[model samples]
Structures are given as C-alpha cells and as structure tokens.
Target: MLGLTQSQEKGSDDTIDDLPQWRRVIPVALGLCLAFALALLFVLANRAADDREDALGNQRRSYEVIAIARNLEGTVARAESLLARYVVSVDAKDGQRYSDQWRLAGTLIENLRRSSRDDPDKLRYIGLLRDSYAARGKTLNDIALRTTYDQRLGALGRLYEANRTRDADRIQRILTVIIGHEMKRLNERSTLLDRSTMRADRLAGSYGLVGVVLLVAALVALWVANSAFTERRYARRLADSEARRVDHLELAVQNRTRELEVANGRLRTEMEERAQAEESLRQLHKMEAVGQLTGGIAHDFNNMLAVVIGGLELARRRISGRGDTGGATTNVGTSGVGTGGKSEHGRDTDDAVRHIDNAMEGANRAASLTRRLLAFARAEPLLPAEVDANQMIQGMSELIDRTIGDQIHIVMEPGAEDWRLWADRHQLENALLNLCVNARDAMDGKGTITLSSGQVTLRPGEINDCPGGDYVRLSVRDTGHGMTPDVLSRVFEPFFTTKPVGKGTGLGLSQVFGYIGSCGGEIRILSKPEQGTEVQIFLPRSQRSGEREASRLLTEAAMAPAAPRRSVFVVEDDPRVLAATVAALEELGHHSVSCDHPAQAADLLAQYPGTDIILTDVQMPEMTGPEMIAQMRARGIALPVLFVTGFAGDDAEAGLLDNEHVLRKPFTLAQLDRKIAEASSAPARGHKEAAA
Candidate 1:
C-alpha cells in the first residue's frame, strides 16, 4: 500500500511539470498567429490607401489637362478675332490699325502654344490653335498684297474681293469646334473628379474604420501584455523576497555559530588569563566604542568638506584679478587690512593674525571642494551653443600635447571642413583634456594618443538603438595599459577607481559621462586586457546650418567687448559672494549700483536709467530674479539684461542660457565686464537702412 501511494505522488509531480509546457506552448502559438494576422492586415490597408491616393492624383491631372485645353481654344478664338479685324483695317486702308491687330493676334497664338506645351491633349489643341491663326494670317497677307497706297478705293475693293472675310469665318468655325471639344473634355474631367472624390471618401471612411478596429486590437494586446508583465513582476518580486528571507535566515544562523565559537575560544583563553587582564579588557572596550563614534563623525565631516573646498576653488578661479592667484598675503594691505592691525610684537601678534588668516583659508578651501563635487555631479548649468567641433579639437591639441609631456605622441586628425555639433565648447575641451591626461597616466607618459573627429550619418535602424540621428564622432584611441573587462565595465560608475592611493579621485570618467549625456551625446568604451581602449563619443550634429560658416559676431565688441564704466545694478543674497561680486565689478571698470536682493534692485531700476544693464542672480531670497526682470521690463526700464547665477534647473532661464543675452554665473570679471559693455551700447539714431 505504501509503494502504490509513492507512485501516485510521483505521477502527479510529472503531470504538474507537463502542465507548464502546455500553458507556454498555447500562448506562444496564439501570439504568433495573431501577429501574423496583424502584419497582413497592416500591409493590405496601406496598399489600399496608396491605390486610392494614386487614383485621386490621376483625376486631378486629367482635370488640369482639360482646363489647359480649354484655355488654348479661347486663345485661338482671340487670334481669329484679331486677324479678322486686321483684314478689315487693311481693306479700309488703315495700315497702323492693321499692323496693331496683326501683331496682337501673333502674340496670342505664341502664348497658347507655350501654355499647352506640357499636356498632350492641350498640345493637340495648341496645334489646332496655331493652324487657325496661321490660316487667318495667310488670308490677311493676301489682302495686304492686293491693296496699294496709290489706289486707295481700289485697294479696299481688292481686299474685299480676296475672300479674307470668308477665311476669317472658317477660322472662327474651327475655334468653335475646338472649344466644344475642350468643354466636353472638361465635363468628363468633372465627372471623373466627382467619382474619384466619392471613391476617396469611401476609402477614407473604410480606412478610418479599419484603423479603429486596429486600435482596438492594439489596446487589447497592450492590456494583455501589461497583465502578463505585471504577473511576471509580481512573481519576480515574490521570488526575490523569498530569496532575501532565506539569505537572512542563513546569515543569522552563521553569525550565531560564529558567536558560539568565539565564546568557546574566549572561555579557553579566560582560564589562562584569569589573574592578569582585567584593566586591558576594560580599556579595549572603551577604545572600540570611541573608534566607532569618531568614524561616524569623520564621514559626515568629509562630505561637508568636499562641498566647501570645491565651491571656494571654483569661485576663486572664476574670479579675475592680478594678485588673486598667490593666496591672500599679497592683498593684505591694499585689499583692506588696517595699518593698526599690523604686528609689532613679531610672534604673539603674528600668531593671532595667522590664526584668523588660517580660518579664512579654511573657508576658501571648503568652498573649492564643494565646487569640484558639483562639477562632477553636473549640478551647474551648462551654456550650450552650436560649436565647430573640428576647430575646437585643433585648438586644444597644442595644450593637450604640452600637458601630457613630450614623450607621449599626441596626434589630432580633425576633419577638413567644420562639423557643427551643439555642446558647451569649454566643457567639451575639459572632457577631452581629462581623457588625454588619463591616457598619459595609463601609459606612464610614453604612449601614442590619437584624437580623431569626423561627421557620420546614421540610418533609421542604427540610430533607433541610440535614440538616434546624424552624429559627429570624436574618437580617442590610446596605445596604453588598457583596462581589463571587469574594470572597463565599471569605468563610468561613480567613485570606482583602480588607481594607486593618492593618485586619483575616481570622478574623472564620471564627470565625462555626465557632460556628454547633458549634451545629448553618447560615449562608448571598447577595451581589452592587454591591448588598448578606444573611447568614442557620438554628438548629434546640428543640421540647420550644415557646411555654412558659423555666424560668430564679427565685431570685437560683440564677441569680447571693453569693460563697462557706466552705472549697473547688481543683485545677490550671499554676503561674501556680494562683496566678491562688488570687488570684481570695480576691477572691471564698472560703477556698480549694488543691492543684496532682487527687490532692492527693482527699486533702484525704477529710480535710474543711467543703470545701463541689470545683472542679477536668479535664485534670490525675497523674489526670484527672473520675476524681477519681467517687472523691470514692465516698468519701462527695458535696459539690456544679464543673469549671473549658479541655479541650473530646467526652467525658462535655463533654456535662455544658449542665447548670448543670458550670461551664466561663476563668471570671470573679464566676462562680466565684456557682457555689460555689449548690452549698454547706445541705440541706433535713425530708422534708415544702413549701408551694407
């Protein structure tokens, strides 16, 4: 009895396995059959729509031909009338009138021939129109020869006797028959267009109905697919949850076993050390707790320190001046430390001043660190423009070669003509330089780095995988110690680096990835363990101005203008930032009309037009600066505008960053100075068109 029950259970398990196979096969068969039917239906519907459109086109062409034929007939009639008048004028002995009518009739016939040149039916009518005109001309010529200046009355008599009137009547009859034939052809075309339109309407209605049916089918398929996907996801989640639970239970059991083993070992050790280690154990426990607390604090401090140091460094570098580079010592007297504050006691006072200076130095270092982190994250707004990729590559080659050292051969193969790609040129240059440096480091300063750029046209299928289009490819190939497959896979992953300690931050590749992605471009890496790595970036090409010269403003003032001396209103909230901004403006030769907030700037704008341009930060405390610009414009102070801000959100102002009129922040004093002058130029005096 026990053997029989086991056999029954074994058979039931086999049946369960077989049930899945049948279920899969049934759905797969149904799916394939439905897909095949849908494909056939699509092809048939497209073909029918194409056929109907072709038929409508044929009817339209037929109508055009008939209309042209009718026009030819009318022209022929006008020629006949003019020829009859010419004959009558000659018979009456009026040479001027006869010559005028003859010339007019000739023009009408030529026009008719030219008009019907393309259509076969119209060309046939044109031929008849020409014949009738020629016949009339011949009859007129006979009359003109018969008439003479000496015998005026006899000329009139001879002109009538020549039967020119009879020939004119014959031409008119021909024109009438031609016009009738054209009218019949026009009627036929009208019938055809009517029938074609009706047929097209019927086909359109049928196609719409079919489209509705297809749409319903598509909706049903989507519903089924979504249902299946949801079921699969639910199953996966359940599986994952069960796996995680099992793993947790297993880990707990292992941990408990480890604790037991440690306890047993300690028990054996305790017997040996019972009389000699009470103080040591107490000290060890205290050290462990302190270490954990210290580690937690250090981690938090490290993150904050990164932000502060990065921000200050960015601000300091972007700030322009002569002595700003060699630390704050050179500017101690001239930049605003009082004479009384100078040290007379050499060591004590010196130490006091040194501490304050050290504190300031610490703040600056912290800001610098934050800015670097921000750059890696791409939190700053990028100013993208249509750049000539070849020019930029060529321009950076010399700098790159120098930085990588003379031992490394840095080769640049830029395309002959300009390849326009939309990206921030400065950021792109930085990315390229970073890659070159990395390559140099990989080779230990002795390998070949080839930087090549060219344009590429992608086909529909190829681009679809990449969200594709025409792209400009910039490839960098290095003969260096290439990364292994495992390393290459995690190359762009943030904070993943294989460099020796103190040599890298692991953010270089991450920054490159972010910048390329921001510009709607893609980067691909191909590497082998001992061979080489090829990093290629595909940047979408700007199609509008292909092969044309970049419309870079020709005037020096437009591109890089002189410093502004006129009054300008500046608005920002950060205190140290405000002071730094004011100092930068003064150095730029600007008489700054300064405010700490946008509201104050708005009030100042309302009070002054001598304020040539408005320079304001976007993210302000009381009111946003964009709103302030709108308010200034409303208040009739439509002075030229410029924005200096670090806020780079996807908003209206971010979109305007591409325009020359909108300047981005962390700007140099020189850049701010240049923009101010350009915006503050006097308006043109008159409305007269200037000489080119």
Candidate 2:
C-alpha cells in the first residue's frame, strides 16, 4: 500500500508541471489573438481612410472643374459686351479690353481641359467648348478689326447679326453641360464618401467591441492559469500594447482630419477671390453703360435745344427790331413771328419780346445742362484756350450773384494777374457757376461763399493726383453743412447726390471732376461734419497769353462791321433745325440754300458752284458732313467748310475737319454771324490737300 501511494504522488507532480505549461500557453495564445485583431483592425482602418480621402479628392476636383466652367461662361459674356461697346464707342481701350477678356477665356478653357483630363467624357465636352470658343473668338476678332479700321457702322451691324445668330449661346450651352457633368460626379463622390465614412465608423465600433472582449478573455485566462501571477503580468502587458495601438490609430485619424480642414480652407479662399473678381467686373460694366447712355441722351437733347433756342432768338429779334432786314423780305415761317412789317402796337411788341427773352433764358439753361452731361460722359468737344482765372472769376462774379440769389454773399479772392490756364473758357465758366450753385444749395442760400484763387506749385503726391507743376488753384468754399467721410469719398462719382430727388441733378461735382480731368488738372474736396466744405480746382498753368489774344479777337469780331451777304449752303438733317438755321442765316443778312441730307449736299454744291461757303452738320445719315466735304474736295469743290453740330462726339471726331471751322448749335445771331465770317475768311485749301 505504501508503494502504490508513492506512485500516485509522482503522477500528481508530473500533472502539476504540465498544468503550468498549459497556463503559459493559454495566456500567450490570447495575447497573440488580441495582437492580430488590433493589427488587422488598424490595417482595415487605414484602408478605409485612404478610400475616403480619394473620394474627397474626387469631390474637390469636381467642384473646381464646375467653378472653372462657370467662370469661363461669364468671361465670354464680358468679352462679348466689351466688343459691342468697342463697336459703339470706337475706343482703343474697349478694344484692348475685349482682347484681354477673350484671352482670359482661353486660359480658363485650358484649365478646364487640364481638370477634365481624367474623364474621357468631360474631355470630349471640353474639346467641344474649345472649338466653339475659338469660333466665337474669331468672329469677335473680325468685328474688333473692323472697328479698328474705322468701319464702325459695319462692325456694329456685324455685332447685331452675331447676336441674332446666337453664336454665344452655343458656348453657354456647352458650359452648362460641362458644369452639369461635374456636378453629377461631385454628387456621386459625395455619396461614396458618406458610405465610406459610415463603414469606417461601423468597423471602428466592431473593432473596439472585439478588443474589449479579447481583453476580458485574456484576464479570465490569466486568472484560470496555475501560475496566475506571471500570466497576469503578461496579460496586463498585452492590454497596454493594445491600448497604445488604439492611440496610434486615433492619432492618424486626427492627422487626416487636420489635412482635410486645411484643404477646405484653401478651397473657401479661392471661391471668395473669384466672387470678388466677378463683382468688380460687374461694376465696370455698369459704369461704362451709364456713360454711353448719358452721352447718347445728351446728343439728342442738344439738337432739340438748338431748335428751341434758335426759334426763340429769331422771334425776339423780329419783335425787338434787332433783325437786320437789309431791305430783304423776311420769311420767318412758323417761328411765332408775323410776316408783316413792324407792328404799330409797340407796347404789345415789347411784352412779346420780353416773353421771348425769358423763353431764351430757359432754353439756354437746358443747353448748359446737356453740356454738363456731355462733359461727364467725356464726349463733349472741348475748345480749349488760354484763360486768366482772376479775370474769369471777376467777370462771373455778377452772374454768380444773380444765380445764387440775393441771400447768399459772394467773396472773391483773385489769384495772381498772370495765373493763366489753358482750358475751355465757356466750360470753365459753367464749372464755376455749378460750384457756386452747389455751394448756395449747401448753405441753404444764406451763407458766405468765398471764391478764392492763387497760383500754386504742386509736388508729386502733394495734392489729389496732380503732377508736380505750377497750377492755378481756384477754390469755392462755403460755410454750410459739410459731408461725412462716406459721402466725401463718393462725392466725385457721377450721379451721386446727397440732396433729395429733383433738388439736384447729382452731376454738379461729377461735371467739375470730369472737366478738371480733361484739362490735365485735378480737383480736391475737403469737408468735415460741421466745419463746412471746400472744393479746390487746380488747373495747369498756361505759358501763352491766351487771355489778351482772346480779348483782342473778341473785340475785333464785335467791333468789325457786318459781313457781306453771300450764298450759304446749309446742309442739315432735321427739318426743324434746317429751317431754324436758314432763318438765322437770313437774319445775318446772308442768302441761304438748305438741304436736309448730307448725300445731296455734294450735288447741291455742284449745282450752285457760286456758293461762297458750305455750312454742314457734322453727323448725318448716309454720310457724315466731313465725308461729304471730302467728296466735294475730290471733285475740286473746296469752298471753305463750316461744321454745325449739337453733339460732335469726342475731341478727335470734333476735330475731324482740321481746316474747317466748327460752330456749336444753340448759337446767338452774333455767334452765327461771327462763325460765318470766320469760315469765309479761313484760307481755302486745295482739293488735294483738303482730301488728304
């Protein structure tokens, strides 16, 4: 019995040794399983992240492509608009702008091509868009070339034809298709991104649960082992390792999220920049259109004012016995003048004359307003001459007093005696008058307006954009309510006014600004909330003694005897203007022959080869007056030409006939007589020279 008991004890000891080995194996196996699970989860998570990133990248690319396509459409539209304006204005700047915008469109197309390189379908659309844009670009180029060659009418016609044909529409449609395709791709990628994110979330949750289960299994296995203490230490070490792996996964996710945020920030910035560019383009277009519109309306308005002013002056002369009948029968027509001899009712005639004078005053004021509009549009033809600022202000003092009313006081601070400037004298007077009127309005017609002038030497950056030079500074300061910073900043903007509607035209300051700029000068305004406003006009100093020469010419013309009667061929388009001009010529003691069309003027001149002078309108249908004159010169009919126009376009077009004399419409009889004398006395040019 002792030997058997010893044998059982030996077997128990061997089993015990084997049990310790099993405990080590079980814990090690559990740790290995946990490690494999964590590694596999990490790999899966990394793969899911990569897939999401790819989806996001695709979405971002699609958005970029879409934005580019939209911008390309807008660029093409802007280019076409500029081309139309170029045709209308015949401006070199507008033509250059069109070319720039078209080139920018080409660049956008290239960007679209690059963005769509990965998609065969999108690439095909881009190719189509490119071809269409190229075709349109060629058409626009032809129009611009025509305009550059001075074929404005032909260019305008072609532009209208292109619009009717919807050439630009094809480009728009192609862009729409491109944008739509990108949007679809973007939506699909977004859906994929959402699915990937959800899958990653689910995988993470599953991996976390599995890891927890594995951790519990490892702890239970360690507790069940024979050598629990050593096994527990090993299990704790495995748990720590698993936790570190989880930390590593979380860190990688945070890094990816930060990268996404940075990319999104860049995208937002790009979108904002694009928006700002679009807004600036829109503002430019709006201002350009407004200027063109203002010019057109002012042109037509001037023509009507000519008829009114001319008719009124004719009526006044007849009633007041100022008409130089010169023993010739007067044919006044429907100009509110009687065809009989002087009326015996002298008092009634005096009343009639006074009424006509009042009418003339109002008509002249309307004409002045149109001149301001033309000036603002940069379309007025400026006849610049040397001017003495002090003399001009002195001469205008009385007119300013009468214009500003008795309540407002006028203070004159004349500048140097030799402070002369080269500018349009009449326009300068109008500018001063406008400033005085604005001051009077600002002060509610009851404040002191100091009109000061002096010679100033300006340095670079010393004043409002005036170059370093000697300038005649003319200031109009008023003790009135001043302007805020916001109002002051925009004071020079056209059609911007702080006054109530109808109280002001909003063009007072704008006209001053444009006129000053045209004279190669600068204008500055200084104002405070309650300190009153001061407007300073800096006109470039002229070296010539224009004031004395101008006075001499005026004295000579005014003192000179009446011109001899001669045959005047008047070429006018409007019948009313034609009749009014004929009456004025007759009133000036000259025989007048009238033709309503420029095309007929050449034939009429040939028929009346004894014509002493040619009086023609500048702009007419079928042919311009200069063109007709050229034709006449071609046929060896170079009688001195006098151009009559209400709106003579810009300075370049106004001076088209360099050798010919120009007489603005809405003229007084004296002005008409003076211009006629000037035209007749201007040495006639040979046909060859005139045509050239």
Residue by residue across 94-135, what tens digits does model 1's lDDT show? 444555656665665565456445557756765765676676
Native-to-model Cα distance after best TM-score fit, residue 173 in candidate 2, in Å? 12
Instruction: Tell me the lDDT of model 2 at 83.
Output: 76
Off by over 4 Å in 2: 1-301, 315-344, 376-378, 386-420, 425-451, 455-470, 478-517, 524-533, 541-559, 650-652, 655-660, 686-692
How large is the C-alpha RMSD of every model relative to the true structure? Answer: 41.8, 12.6
Collision count of model 2 = 0
Task: Report the error of model 2 at residue 624, Å.
Answer: 2.2
Which predicted model would earn the best TM-score? 2
Question: Candidates' TM-scores?
Answer: 0.37, 0.56
In model 1, the Cα lDDT at residue 249 comes to 52
